[model samples]
Target: MTSFLERARSDIGTAPIAALNVGARRFSAHRDHAVEAFPAMDDMRDRAREIRLHTLANLDRYLAQFADTLEAAGGDVFFAADAREANDYVVQLARARGVQHIVKSKSMLTEELRLNDALEAEGMEVVETDLGELIVQLAKDRPSHIIAPVLHKTRFEVGALFEEKLGVPYTDDPIELNSIARRHLRPLFLTADMGISGVNVAVAQTGSICIVTNEGNGRLTTTAPRIHVAMLGAERLVPSIGDMSVILEVLARSATGQKLSVYTNVLTGPRRPGEPDGPDELHVVIVDNGRSKVLEGQGSEILACIRCGACLNVCPVYRTVGGHAYGSTYPGPVGSVLTPALFDLDEWSDLPYASTLCGACLEVCPVRIDIPRLLLGQRRLSVQTRTGPMWMRRPLRAYASAATHPRRFRALLRIGAAIGRLFRSGWILRLPWRGAAWTQGRDLQTPAKSFHRRWKGRNRGS
Candidate 1:
């Protein structure tokens, strides 16, 4: 119900346009060319799905390999079973190193767990360095979309959010806005004690962590701090950098319609003895949370998600209601299936039903995840258990009985239609609770008897 999520307001200071630029680019790109734009990239979705399924099947093996290689590369690797445990590990490490200021790249896993809020609650000054995330952080707004956090904000709205929240002189020019953001965050990037980033892919063989971003903040976030920490969902691991290449090939093109992000950094470990610029200490947090559980269940197909946000771009429901209506950190169709599978289904019962059973999410999925199937699965589970509403359950049963029972159902439908014919002045259902709600607003013509009745009548030559 809150318009914005609770994050530090000081984070987006003076750079409201950063939000607008990131948000605008996503909306505009999708607006102009979404379903039609990525025709060439469709096969990549199948490839990505195969690779993810393969990796998940061999997850334990791949995980061990990833951690061992990181250890071999002088990177400390810690595996936490859940979000609380994962953030605790990072906080303890930061406190041990006497770290105060923290800068972070965009990471959805953190947002899912509200990790930044947890860190801030512990009195750590955590800053989101991604331009969109930075704007949302300053505006105290939850991300409207995963890939682009401020996707719902218009430039004018962003300018106003900046002026009202950041005390910046309001301006809407894209170039002017970007300059202000860069100028404002330049100092924070340099001064931060440790940097946190999300891993796009973790190469098990090379022990390298990869990140892709349009802005250079990810580079600054990972390298500038003395200590660098990267947290990833356990599913993010790929077998090797070779496997990583296939994902990267599809990730950007599917996500932003670009061949590559402006910054694609692969970090192996701590700064080598002779290396000029890198973190002195590198720590990788592999958080299982509910992902291990996710990989085990029918809903596991969601794990194949590479988070391109193409699903959001094409979903009619997502476009209409937006992400906030989903009421989870992860929203849209992916969120509809994922959040409940990973968390409590009861808490998110409304979410699964929020969809129109549309297949747009699956169509645009770079991994070819059958999102609509999973959503329907969730709905069936919820409905069977009465986790949904009495209103739905009662009417659906009556409808089901009527459809399944032939003669009785047809007779009842005929009676209902005959009664409805009273309101039909020239087939216009212009009647003013129950059926009137449909009739009063629009033309609700009663069917000319039941289809089965008509079929029987025609068969008998009645």
Candidate 2:
């Protein structure tokens, strides 16, 4: 199996790398400008963080309240402990409802659960309606960015993909490309029996689910089908609409630099008696999928994330290597802390190190999650569990030993400087062990002399 460093190296100097740079820079600029324009940005971020903290602290009460309110309003609420349960419930519901045709908006939960694959295995024709998601689906590829799924692919690449997959006239124009996608997906939405979506915020007070998006697909997916399934992460809840409003405010500015998304559809229940365009049956799936464990752990603060993707845009590591290198559903500074907390620490140990811990992510986050601290926490856990790579142990131990003694520390530094001087190229191209990982992407400049030596020489001369 290829390592994260290996995958990251492959993307460097490639078209995808260029695309990542452009996309990240554009989004980051938009966020900065939006925040600059809004004088209440700081206050809103603080409020949003407080709301998230309160909700997480009392998640059980809110979850129960949300479920009770939704159920009382003729909507079915299912609490899923894991992915298997969530997928099984959705699949069984589809089968029972005779839902052979399914259309979905951009749903990160569904992606995390691999819902499309599961439904497809049961002979359902699952179609993605979001433009970026459609492109990803047609190409059988994963989303590279959380909000902008196809940020890694250039327009030309998308044009080519559409041309090959949809058998359409090749055009790279953004407007024309969107038109083509709309032309293809509109019919599917009209004919789909079920529509699946991700809930951005669930209001426990009113039992309403808020869907935020830039495209019309979110609305169409929810209203177009007879059966609408909204997947809500157990942690994505607020006590009331007022709290939801604060979250939405920061989410839009942080995500796309808008005061509001083009569509912020809040659906309380299934169609009312007089409603013309609405789903006949609304099902809310509250998915745990290890989130409860995350809430109890050192990384509990991560549940406060609003999926704004602000961290990704401002993150240097994410900008450099892009999302696919992380090999997880989520990516960037948020993912570094989240993936390991949600999944296996040993398996995803590399994710925590993906960051430079530069604190760029914390600066941009809407909920103010301390991602660097959480990353360090994960690293500490990995070491305690002996899950970190064996190569790292000895070096760390040697450093720890030397750090406690001045003479040994100086001796080690002198030896390192002497070895560094042996390299004539002025840079160490390759390191002997785990240091090879560091040298892979950048050159380590050779040290001419240790700081101790220079200090001693100056003192003696003086």
Candidate 3:
């Protein structure tokens, strides 16, 4: 198994540059539109932050209120502690309903749970209705980016994928490709036994599940089947409609530069008796999946994310290596802080180090999440808890000890300069022990002298 850094280095070469160019261009448009649309963008973000903070602080009360209201409106609510529980609940529900096929909208929560795989394991065919998701699904690939699941695939690649998987004549034209997908998926929508979706914002006051999408799949997924299941992170809730509106204002602008997404559906319950369409049964599964634990520690601030994917688009590292490099459901800056927080730190310790800490992610984030600070905190926790490699910990500790003592520090600096001089070629080809890993892709040049020493000599000469 290749490591995260190794895989990232490989992808930097194999991933298409055109895909990255498209993402960059789209993100630039989003940034420009956000500036023009909201002159008080900063103020709006501050308010959004306040809303998240308040909602999280009172999350328990709000969750209870949401459940009671949803149940009163004839919807069943289930709280899942982890991925297994969430998957089991959905699978059991499908089994009870004898659901043979499921049509799904774009939902990162479902990805996090690996719900489709679970459902498939239980012998049900699941279809992804979102265009990007459909492409990835047809190719048997995982989503590479949060918002654009196929952001790393070019039109040519998608055309090939469609041809191979759907048996449609290959054409790289965007309009024709969309027409082909719509034609292929229409029957699935009409015949699906169940529909699964992800909730963007769950309004506690009104018991509403809100979803924002550029495509109409969300509406179809929720209404076309006899049973509708919507999954959401427990933290993805707002206290009232007013707070939801504030978030919506920033979400669309930050995500895709649209003043608002093409579709924003707010469903209060399943179909009512008088309703002409919608599922007969509605189930809302609120998944914790280690999020509550994040709230209990220094990582709680990460819950402020609205899943805009702005941080990913602006991150230099993500742009270079793409999302598959992280090897997690969420990728890029938010993923760096989030994966470790929501999962085992020892297993994912490498993710937190995958940033330049340039603060670009912070600048672009609509909710003002301090991603760099959180990443640093994760590093501190890893070292303090001895979860990091022993070799790394020993060197870091030695460096810290020496730097605290001026005499020792100066002596080490002189030794380093001497070593550099010994390497007459100017570059250190290899480092001893774990330090060797740092030079795998690039050479490290030995410093001729410390900056402090150079500055001291200049001052004396003057």
Each prediction's whole-model lDDT (CA): 0.80, 0.91, 0.90
TM-score of decoy 1: 0.87
Which segments of model 2 are wrong by more than 4 Å? 398-410, 417-455
RMSD of each: 5.3, 2.5, 2.9
Off by over 4 Å in 3: 389-394, 397-409, 419-452, 459-462
Q: In model 3, which residue pairs have backbone atoms overlapping below 3 Å?
A: none
Tell me the tens digit of each residue's lDDT in model 1 across 1-462: 221121112222234434433553565375346435656556655677788889999999999999999999999999999888998998899889998899999999888767887788878999888888988888888887878887767677768877787678999877877777788788998899999999999888999999999999999999999999999889998887778888987788778777777899999989999999999999999999899888888888788788778777777656656666677878778888888899887766767766777686666677888888998898899887877545466788888888898997879867887786676563665554566755765786555665887688789954
Rank candidates, TM-score, best first.
Answer: 2, 3, 1
The digit string of per-residue lDDT tens for model 2 on 1-462 reads 555777888886788878988998999999999999999999999999999999999999999999999988889999999999999999999999999999999989998898888999999999988898998888888888989999989999999999998999999999999999999989999999999999999999989999998999999999989999999999999999999999999999999899999999999999989889899999999999999999988789999999999999988888888899988999888888888899888888778878898999998998899999998998898889978755466778888899999999989887887787689788888897768878987889887665877799889957
Reference-based TM-score of each model: 0.87, 0.94, 0.92
Best by TM-score: 2
